[model samples]
Target chain A: MTTVPRRDRPGFYYPKPPATWWLRRPNYVLFMLRELSSVFIAIFLVLLLVQIHQLSQGPAAYAAFVERLRSPGWIAFHVVALAFALYHSITWFNLTAVVQVVRLGERQVPPRLVAAANFLLWGVVSLVILFFFLLGG
Target chain B: MSTRKTSEPFWWGLFSVGGVVAAFLVPVHLFLHGLAVPLGWIPVSPARIQALVGHPLIKLYLFVLIALPLYHWAHRFRFILEDVGLHALRAPIAVLSYGSAVVGTVLTLWVLLR
Candidate 1:
């Protein structure tokens, strides 16, 4: 009788499933969420493009587009899309610190720091834009 | 083993720049769509949009804001897929992401110029 290697043996002793297909990894769930958010991003882009096209056409066309956006159905769509986009943005920003190869002379900067900085910078920029728009000019 | 940096420079550059742009642009986007409109401060009108985009400085800013961030987001997304061991899909995803950004840039430039 041929004996299989201990590591290769399929039994309860294995840390993971013998086959990749049988594993339900947490990373898989994350990947799905990230990819699913792309659909929302696409939808948002289409809406923006349509608005841009209308803006180019003249006042009446633009007005019609805006009116359409104000409809309850469209507003609901925007709300859902915004939720997805926000989730995507937050997740992606957090991942940035991990994937980028950042090194210091001796001590490496923490990934959490990078993520925090990103969020802080965003907050500041948003405030600045809001200030400008609200204060006039 | 090949020592050359496997990552594409254009894509990396886009990602870096896009990260910075997105950091700023996203907040502005939220404020514009979320706060301003809700507060009844700025009406969504063609004249308002034209005035916003028509200013030379604002036009330049918008171009950078829209193009760079999209490119950045796409590149990051491709990397996320790669990290998940979806290596087989890498090439196709990279091409699609970069191609879309290029097309978006062209369209945006056309709008700004016209």
Candidate 2:
């Protein structure tokens, strides 16, 4: 599935790929998994919306929501969601070099340096948010 | 297909912006809210968090955080469907994919702004 099968012309060849084509190759499988990460992240967003709604219902409702989230099932779901969120973040940040090019004078920076810079920024941002969450309040 | 005439670039631009936003922010948000607060790593107080959420800057931040990554998901998920042999159903799938993101974005706005 590297290249899409174009629309079949009158006499041209366009092989009909099976539904399981992505499963045949490890890279394709990995790609599909990465795409799938969005689904989990989107669901996580919906859960967040629900959480905010709970908060809007005042302290008691928010506390009840937190209590429900503390259950084993919700905690397990969160674990999986966090795993996918990390996967999405790592892959997205790793592609920064390919997607964005930085220049020093007339020369382009090395891809490794670009990727490293992204990772470093990610760490700083994560630390700041963590600080806010853990202590700012 | 004339790419210039259509709105693909607009969505792609959003996808790129959303990619940057999600890559930088989502992981930390997930870690703190999903695991830390729930599992007792960080203290979970409803009033404290509510107070934080009530701030205008935090409300705007929340709106951006929840809305942008949605477009990223929509664009990627659309291509994923196309690549996996659903290229024939491109029209409806594109609608459903982006339409859901649009809905999610509206929902986010309603929740955050309210």
Candidate 3:
């Protein structure tokens, strides 16, 4: 059975979106930014691992690295990375509401409730981290 | 575009788990070490931070935090590049992306163990 390929036939124009298609809509841009956030977060992890490696080297090396971080450029980078990481977390939690649907008896749990729960958990976890810093132990 | 492969689910499974881990843990880590201590918002010293990292539980936490997110980033970045029209290099992109994550995971474990 010999069949002609669809693309080989006439009038089969499949439009390809431009590279900047994300700029076409606000939501699309947001989605792209959310995806891009992972890169910054990964970079942060690598730097943290490097810091850990420095810690293993000696106190002097670790202190030097920490001292270097006091520069304005590093601070600005951290600020931007913080924004991206927070955005990534929020978007990921909201996505959980869509991905996991729970049913109680005959009624399904509302997505808003799910999202709220996620935010609440996030808040609690953040507070616990803050508590550690506050307790200084 | 090339068709999806059977192995996609396996890689995607890692990506999903990584996303969940990153979403829950990453922000808090950034807020504490990345922002607070560095900015002088928290009065913790480097020795204190080092001792915390020396703890077994924190080491394990760091391992999971650093390793999984690499894969998550790899998967997302691969798709983004492809969607933006790097379809011809899909196979190579997948290899490069996932390879970096694997290398990252190894580096994380080695550092934590040391």
Candidate 4:
């Protein structure tokens, strides 16, 4: 009888990607930062939700909470979070061009135009918000 | 590898929708609340904002704004951690990440209802 080969026998060695793989390329660094932007945005949302909770507590509590955020350190943290949130938003908008396919007749819509349209919509919405909060107030 | 089907597509679907929502709305919110308000570029009181939040429409808006990005964050962070070489802990990590998002969503709904 022929001897059967064991299934658990040694195979070719497969090298694992290094922990510093992101450091190898600029695009990798950008990708990591983009991924990290979500975390920063999440932190901001948590802070906002906490503020709303304070609001429910009463005006004094809400005013006190907002006052606490005026500290230089907290302001700086918000600044950084804002930057990350903006970065995340921009990258995501750009990606919509890739994920969505729009064809006009037999011709495909250009990705650049798609991205521009996204940016335009973003601008319009932001402006509406600004009008409501900044000027209207 | 086991032939078990994954719920990854479902989670990814949420992430995709959340990404669109976050991209469209989050930056403006951040700019208004974080930078403009604190620096006094816009003169609005806490009471005004509280009243705004009290509206039913605003509550629904906040639910969408706060809840979806959470799952988006969860999914992205899960992959990032995995990429950094925590391959062995995939299942536990997925549970923890998505579970946190679900908890956040519930908290948002509770706060809105209150």
Candidate 5:
């Protein structure tokens, strides 16, 4: 007598399905965060353009624009957007080393070095800007 | 050996050039807005802004700074998305980024001219 293999049998090959989407795949969460941060960049540009328009109009319009930016609602918007921008900056900087290729003969520069350089450059730029601002130049 | 072409050179070139330009322009921008005008160091008149923007040299500088940074940013963002496993969306992302850069440059030029 030939025995038929059980179609409903569950063994090591396939025991049970994943409990949830998160359990099945975890990277999607980070992907969503990164993509969502792009919205802040768009928002920032719009804010800047509006400010430029106000400046072009005249002093009164510019003053109104500045006042609007200082409002609670705008402040809150900027705070949230700033957080997103920080996240974007961190992630983007981390990727810089990976994307850039530097080779000295057969030896390649490390990615960490690239990332470090980028951060350092940012620091220097910030300092210069601060200096110029403080010096009233 | 089948040689694989690497994108590293292009990326490095872009970042290097951008880094240098940013190092210079950012300070000038900050000074103009923060110290020069706000602190009453260099005078905070609207006429100053108009004059600065009207200068041919300053206008050219602004154009380069705006256009190059936009291009660099768009390229970087496109690659970042691709690296994160969104290969299918690369075409659309590239189009959107480059298109926005071009539009932005045109708009900025119009504003400056007016």
Candidate 6:
């Protein structure tokens, strides 16, 4: 159960891929981009935490934070972050079909249907958030 | 080469759950908070958002939204570091990445509840 795949094993040729291997193939490029997406998302969450902390500091502080957020630099950062976030969502849902196998009695649901269900749920969740943001007053 | 009990599964579970959260929830938030509201496209009164953030349910949502994806980032960033030729330093990388996530989680709780 504890098999180690270390180099220098007898009769084994361990190939260490170069750092740029991910750049070689289009899928590899996208795969690397997908992994990189979380970093951006994490960065956004940290910004959210800063915004929340500003809110805790009271109205003026929160307003200051909002003003800073409205600056062109922050807006541009967000435009990029939104792009990465969308890529994350699309790739994540696409992979869910492969990872989640839904079963209905004796029949297993098709992978496309599973992914489609996830997309439907994704849309509904998005709409709910939009509602809370725009019209939940 | 140190024989440590692997905590891989625990981290992996968090990664998967965090991935789900990021995929399902991150875009709308990013779009609204990062772009729309900030750009003044969707008018939001400061007091309304203030009240919303103070609500217990919204606090819970914020905690989930901000904290879990951090773990996902930690896990993936660990692999990314290894991929980028830091394989020898993976143990330290794992500690650093996941430790930051833990710190982020604690800070999230403090900000939300305090």
Give candidates' CA RMSD values in order. Answer: 6.9, 2.5, 4.3, 5.1, 9.6, 3.6
By descending TM-score, how would the candidates be arranged? 6, 2, 4, 3, 1, 5
Model 5 CA deviation exceeding 4 Å by range: A1-26, A134-137, B1-100
For model 3, what is the C-alpha lDDT against the true structure? 0.84
Residue A21 displacement (Å), model 2: 1.0
Off by over 4 Å in 6: A1-13, B1-5
Q: For this target, which candidate reaches the highest lDDT against the unseen true structure?
A: 6
State the iRMSD of every prediction, in order shown.
4.7, 1.3, 1.6, 1.5, 6.9, 1.1
lDDT of 6 by residue, A16-103 (tens): 6777889889999999999999999999999999998998788899888989999899999999998999999888988988888889
Q: Could you estimate the TM-score for every candidate?
A: 0.69, 0.92, 0.89, 0.91, 0.59, 0.92
Q: Residue by residue across A70-116, what tens digits does model 1's lDDT show?
A: 67786676677666667766876788778765678877788888888
Residue A73, candidate 6: Cα error in Å is 1.8
* Model 5 lDDT tens row, B1-114: 326696557655654554344433533443344223433455445555555556787667666655444545555567566554455466698778767766877876776567
Q: Candidate 6 on B1-114: residue-level lDDT in tens? A: 456677898999999999999999999999988988777889888788889998999999999999999999999999999887676687899999999999999999999999
Question: Chain A TM-score for each candidate, in the given order?
Answer: 0.71, 0.86, 0.84, 0.84, 0.73, 0.87
| Candidate with the larger DockQ of 2 and 4 | 2
By lDDT, the better pick of 1 and 6 is 6
Give the lDDT of residue A110 in candidate 3: 95
Evaluated on CA atoms against the true complex, candidate 6 attains a DockQ of 0.76
What is each candidate's fraction of native interface contacts (fnat)? Answer: 0.17, 0.68, 0.58, 0.61, 0.03, 0.76
The true-structure Cα RMSD of candidate 5 reads: 9.6
Give one digit per residue, the lDDT tens place, for model 4 in A10-107. 45233457667899999999999999989988888888888889889998997788788878987898888888888887888778897798799999
Q: Candidate 1's residue-wise lDDT over B1-114, tens digit each? A: 346666598788987786556545654564465334533457554466677767899778767866676676677677665554555466898988788888888887877677
Worst 10 residues of 2 chain A by lDDT: A1-10
Single out the weakest 10-residue window by summed lDDT for candidate 5 chain A.
A12-21
